[model samples]
Target: MAGVGTVRSIISDSLGRSVMAEQPPKIVILTAPGEGLPDGLEALSGEAELLVAENGAQLRAALPGAQVLCVTDFRTNAISEAWSAADSLQWIHATSAGVDALLTAEVRESSIPVTNARGIFDRCIAEYVLGQIIAFCKDFAENQRLQQRHEWHHRETEPVTGRTVLVVGAGSIGRQIAQICGAMGMAVDGIGRGARPGDNDFGAIYAQADLISVLSDYDFVVIAAPLTPDTEGLFGAAEFQAMASSARLINIGRGPIVRTADLVSALQDGEIDGAALDVFEQEPLPAQHPLWDLPNVAISAHMAGDFIGWKRALSEQFITNYRRWAAGDALNNLVDKTHGFVPSTTNR
Candidate 1:
């Protein structure tokens, strides 16, 4: 309501033919302070007016008259703070798959359409999840530890084959995990918004409401769901207690989806065998966090979907969508603001 104005339409002329307006649409690229701008954005030169904003002040100045917002820094709150200045905003594209950080009350309640880099991260994140699953079953963590002490101790390790995996979110990333894991002879099931049978990637899809009731059945449980009101703090003591004691947990999803203190308690109490966490409630995790000292946990700096050339990939996806928008074509990865994600319609 702050940006009160009729939504601007730049896709066509009075004739209704798909065409760019006489004036190229202005695109505002938002980045974090000290972070480099996304690569390959020079492609937008001559096609549109490109403005860069690294903070709320810059963004507020850039938002007026800009029709498209490209959020390269998904973690920033600058958008929310500057939403009132977005008088001309018609679309917002998030470089990251998750748009939770960008979905402020003003942005969500507004009529502006939001899109994300959904397909861009599916394979990379799936691979990261698969690697963690292998590490846990093969005892790769212990192997590295014994090597550090220069000790040669024989030990039996579990096999990933024949193990059961439960993916808590049946989105594109989760399906990719199922595809790769199923290729390894493990059985995979998925949890989604509703129950369904005969899913292409998963053996069966169970409604999210059944999550805790079915937790004890799997050897591994993965959190790949986006962070929403329904999913935040989804995994805690009660959920951990529902899993098999031999089960391991892997989370490549947004942090805060799993409660930090509860996860620490679960690991300390041996409620679960181990965990591999890429995202956390607090980034950098603080030097003295108990999770760092725990041998059963694998920690990463929220880099699961970030691979070499990822920045360029994000830029390219934005460019592609921009072209579509200019030509009045449907943009890919459009997020449903109500649900907080692009609802998964196909298995990737």
Candidate 2:
């Protein structure tokens, strides 16, 4: 990665918070090289000093001088390495939607507020989930195989209109998914920590305690919940056993939310008909992994929520909140560190 030098100016963007402070704040951006953030960030260079760090060493060095940290690489544990050095950091913003990797004890206990790019990825992930549902119901995997073999084989595909779906999370992303699935005529059921009457998106809501009993009733099970103490290992052998044999599982949440071995075993035993896994316990899912060989599984490289220009969207969102933060107004998409996600109350 190339080193980026900072250029300071005194001009602040008019869009920034209306409030004025005595001095320009120092902001550090932790990002990989060659990625595009919004172009207009330079306009704020006058209001705040901007520093870019692409790796842990640089991040640690930059942390000592910054009041705000923009973490473009959520997977990096550099925050922990530089926590002691972040004497001036008052706020931390993560570009990625999930903050599981950033929820270390040090960050959790820090007085600094943490926020994430949440709603930006909601629609992208919802569309991906819908696509997976259709693919599984239509048996697109077999269709592709037949195409490769040049075999004129004919098979009956299932209709998704009357099928049922269990959305295991009621956050913005899950609600968006439920809305889409419901509109398409699939019965949408949601499970949340505190289940209540659903809106147009969710056809019905179920408490976590009712999950196992209803597992066998749905044809698709989707995991979109954040990784929290209560939701970790939420799906295991028992849950898999409770699912109908024809049900397909789609996981887009944190990898640790679902147990890998149990999922693979369920597939092997024909406990579930298929799976479309966009996340796993281990990312880049080792090349030798057995899931790759499964005929009934669809695998993606953790890109369900990534669309064209998504990075820029994340950056722009940060900039909007940056303006609000600089003005001392309420920030958007603030996270409740204890739950490892933006609290549902905030989203509503």
The TM-score leader among the candidates is: 1
Instruction: Assess candidate 2 and give its TM-score to the true structure.
Output: 0.89
Displacement of the residue 173 alpha carbon in candidate 1, Å = 0.5
Question: Which residues of candidate 1, in runs, are more than 4 Å off?
Answer: 1-21
Could you estimate the TM-score for every candidate?
A: 0.93, 0.89
Clashing pairs in 2: none
Per-residue lDDT value at 235 in model 2: 97
| Steric clash pairs (candidate 1) | none
Off by over 4 Å in 2: 1-22, 32-40, 346-348
For model 2, the local distance difference test gives 0.85
Q: lDDT winner among the candidates?
A: 1
